[model samples]
Target: MKKFLKIIAIIVSLLGLHSCSNDLEMATVTKPEDGVFKLMSSADNVTLEKENADSQTAITFHWDKSWYGIDTPTNFTVQIDSIGGDFSEPVVSELIDNEKSYTHAELNYIALKFELDPDVEGQLKVRLKANLKYGVMPVYSDTKVISVTPFSTLNLKYAMPGALYIQGDAVATNWSYPIPDEQTMVQIDDHRFGLILNLVGGKNFAFITSSSGWSDPAYVAPDSTVPAEGGEFIPSGSNTTPAWGGTPMRSPADSGTYKIIIDFVEGTYSVEPEPSIMAVPDELYIIGDATPLGWSTGPSQKFTKVDDFTFAITIALTEGKYDFISALTWSDPAYKAKTGSEPLMGGNFIESGSNTVPAWGGSDITAPAPGTYTITVNFKSGTYVLSL
Candidate 1:
């Protein structure tokens, strides 16, 4: 009778093990072969519109959950690369094991990284990356190609200029031609340029696309009027044979750090107080996925102060986003991605500061890719440059 009971217990244990094995199709009873999964997209080609970027989905990518040799929580990363580029150095967008979809802005941001011109269709490759726990190698799904037509971030209403500059007695320059770097206005967007400066109150200033000659277009104040705070302005075309006669902007009654945002799309400009008396802090640090020490709330990487208002650093960065902090914790006095620009990819050297913004909490600055980059920030001018 005892032997019969022992045999019955062994049979029950065997049945339980088999049930668990079936649940974990990838159970490592022996070294299991990697499981396969099919990846599919909702569209073969998509035309991206800026208006619909935030509210709509550009495309949806669904896939079967991948099976590694272990039964653990797996992470899925969607990668994108230029067509025929293989999977090397693709832009990464993370997804959970259960969720699958890509937003228009998210995909469009990746498409632009391939240098796809706005309003033009470009092709790219997509793949799924599955990561497992216990240090096992992550497996990847087969690749698929898609064509995308993306619109420019710049306003389509205005003729985009190569660059913009501010020249006048109110700024560092005295209406000089061939504008210097210091007086050059920071490109804010498709039709806006801005500058933060200690204007010489009561002096006059005007905007210029170039110092080429009298024919170079000039943006001047409307009717020689200066609003009590700030208001509308206009651009002078090159049609006038002689030099322009319209009034340039008059400096405010008070002299201090002020922000000027020139908007070509609306034919207006705005000026206001900025920085809220925040000077260049003595100690500045960068904290984010781009740095050696990632988003840990502990200490972060510091920058070498080149001068009173400038800071610079050369460091190796992964493809991630970051921002500057004055203290050890995420609090006030943080230098976020310049207002009106992508945190990760702000051109080779673009300046960010308009509307006195980048608010207290702004988007983190984006690193172009995984590489060694030099970041230089001029707090006086509220400008930053990222270069590889």
Candidate 2:
């Protein structure tokens, strides 16, 4: 009995020792040191453009995880405050993951509201720390400075005639000027003006003037010179002339001295109108197995009147056979390729045979292939006949 009791005591001691060893191993399991954090702030100065009264600026912070030997960061934290101040109680604290760079535009409105305070000026420091569990210590990025300026001032000087005029048509006169930077507004009289200059790296300025007030103007970096003619505004290519119109400025009749001020503020570009796509009558609509049978009624199909009878349709097509028919009025005698009881052969219609249709119909008539096809009509006192 004494020996059995001694044996049981030994077994209990061994079990306790094994359990303690397991506990120690679990506690020593450390997180990977590969986790690291970095922060980058764009733009040393933040110019809250005139239009951004709400004080919402798009600030971007970028960081890299490769430094820490991690595939990607699981999460990140952004702390922003007045320079050199602790961000533990920051004016703005943002938590983000899935992106190495975070844009302030996506922050909560309350955070933005706090940052927009007028008192928030000077070097705004943005601290970014990434959280990754692996090879190295949590890497921190260098402090970024964002100068919070209320407004940005842009100086406009006439490149050609040293003298600048507050009012009158600068476009009509020979004036050379630099393109306005985006977010800069040029004001003439009570109205705002836009740039119309068409030289390489050059911009033209035009502003609307009224008896009372003027509109605010903004300068956009000139991508290229404005074309001379054609109501359409496009970059000047080798063959096109540069012209400016469509945005008409009211002529100031009374000769009065006015001041022209150019202000630069952050602003958004106005949406441009979509190009028109219209089909002409007496024109053929073609489609094949790849195209819908009733493609004429499709949203992509449209007819626009270039003249009384001439119409145009712009379409994008893939390589395939297409079937088409003319949509001319049945009673129109000028375009009739066939008569009752007499089947009109393909030779009876006109074919251009690979020539692009002229902008307007006149003596120009293109021949067609050996099949029934529709002939384009001209409503302006002229008849268009299609002959093969």
Candidate 3:
């Protein structure tokens, strides 16, 4: 009986060991072979419209399932580049795990990064890369070429130019009176203005459209606090009411720095603490043969601060090509790529460095013609436009 019991215990131990081995089993991973992974979709031309930009998928990419020795998860990424160019400057878009497609809006946004001419068809090279895990070799599928038409979403109707100013008892020079020049507001659009000023708590203020003369089209706040962005205000008794009796906006608890934005179209105003006033750079220089100075930084055109965040330069640009750079070198920090509407336009001021440094060296901003143009750079808004 002792020997029988001992044999039974041995059998139980062997069965337990078998169960543990099965639980710890791992599948054999097979490294994907190069040719096994390929794009399954046809190279069809795609056209994306700016009107349907929201909630739209630009294009869907399909690919054959990657085959490794065992079934394991794989990451897929879609890369794009200018036609016939290497992938060195490839614009990487979608990165998904075990997914097969990307949306139109996603790809459309990526296409804009190329800065393709509006309403023009441009060829782009597309390819897919699949990887199993870190420290593992990634497999690249054959490149596919596709044609795409791109458009700009910027609407000229919503953008315009005009001048604005601050007034009221809260201001030092003009207490309850209008002083246009001393407190003139910088024009953002035909109706909007960006104003930076210091105020005394509990003091009341208002905005006057005129520089020298006071009048009816003045902006008044309804409450003690300034209006927020999209806050609406309609002047009451307009040309009929006393200017001082008109509604006035009062300062907040503590007086310090403030940024005010007034929009006339929507009849709104927003007041908030100035995050931190950006000191207007001592001097902003324009370089290139396009300028009358001809690439000389010293004789470079000087910028006049219209406000704490705006600068303006009115000069004759002789044609060729030009850019705004902090200094006289081909590197950054330089302002390039004048996009938006014709006549009035804007671009980004990219920081310094190579392709690795983001937003550097965009296309040169061209002059409408070989003549003088009034150029304004609003660092706060990240926009620069030329005016006649």
Candidate 4:
């Protein structure tokens, strides 16, 4: 009988141990509550007003609920920085009484200011993050970019004398001009300089000049007077005639100071078209500053060839006035002659007028008084034409 009692006691002890293990497992399965918080206002971006000497813009932040499901969070903090990174312990705000929202009244009253380095010239990243109790990790939102621009100054001056002009054929001349301390005089890129000269009714001449030193004597003029090294002269346009002016004759030995001279004869002058036009094929495509259409080169909206020497395109421009010129893509000779490099057509976007022709090339185009505009392609050319 004693042996039977021992077996029963062992079974009861075993059952009690199994029940305790099941209770511990149930407690482990239960999850802890999550911390609650949310932004009171819904705004993606904000631009604060400029602060005055004594007043600043104010902002408020409200939490969705108390931290850790508690009715009140006694200790709260706020921080700010111009850059986002793994910052050290940040400057914390003072702890306030138990509340769901905090008012930044101090910021509203004091002037808010920041300074940027002189070398930076792009958007700066600013970030704000927060921390709370209840095993919650720090929460962050999108960063903001603040534009920073550097300062600079520019100075301009004419590098050559204003009165300088071309004279005798192949004659040399010298010019004295002031230059900025920071800038240096270099050869003109296109071997040409801006010149203002009055051509006689029947006179033509060719001139040559260089940026190197000038050692040879200046070429002579048709008149008997000696030609000055830095002065103007008239050309006789005759190869056989000897130079009568006192101007010095140039030899192979002279290579220094650059020279330019003009020849005068009875003739009319004509402006030459760009050489690109000659190379364009009979069928060519043009666009850009040379065309009436504003600059755009996408596949959906591009210049299309209409014929051997014509093409068309369409664009939506702002209501205000604008300017454009003809520009070619790849080089082609045949069509270039008809199109030429000059601006082919131009016009205004008006509310109502000559619907066929909007405006003249180099003229202003008015926009609709105030409404959606349906701009049509209405430009034509003798050698070349364009359509919508």
Predicted structure with the largest lDDT when compared to the true one: 1
Give the 10-residue window scoring lowest on summed lDDT in candidate 3: 338-347
Name the TM-score of candidate 2.
Answer: 0.25
After superposition, candidate 2 runs with Cα above 4 Å error = 1-38, 50-57, 91-121, 133-139, 150-388
Off by over 4 Å in 1: 1-125, 129-139, 144-149, 153-157, 176-178, 188-192, 214-216, 238-246, 254-257, 264-267, 273-284, 287-380, 383-388
**lDDT score for residue 310 of model 4:** 34
The Cα error of candidate 3 at residue 270, in Å, is 25
User: lDDT tens string, model 3, 1-388?
Assistant: 9999999999999999998876655444556655556665543687877766666666667776545555567677777886866887687755554344445665566666655555678877888887776736687888878778776545532222345567765666646444744366666644467756666666666776666655456566655444333255545334535534447776665676566776656667777665333334545667777888776655447677676667788778776666776544544456665232223244333333354234453466665677556788765544566754
Which lDDT tens digits does candidate 2 get at residues 246-315?
2422222322212222222221122111111112344444333323333233434433445533543443
User: Runs in model 4 with CA error above 4 Å?
Assistant: 1-36, 39-44, 51-53, 89-91, 97-388
The C-alpha TM-scores of every prediction are 0.49, 0.25, 0.37, 0.22
Model 3 lDDT at residue 56: 66
Error of model 1, residue 337, in angstroms:
12
What value does the lDDT take at residue 51 in candidate 4?
A: 32
Cα lDDT of all candidates, in order?
0.69, 0.35, 0.61, 0.30
Better of 1 and 3 by TM-score: 1
The candidate scoring highest on TM-score is 1
Per-residue C-alpha lDDT of model 1 across residues 233-289, encoded as one tens digit per residue = 655675643445567788888877687777677767777766543467887778888
**What is candidate 2's CA lDDT for residue 78?**
63
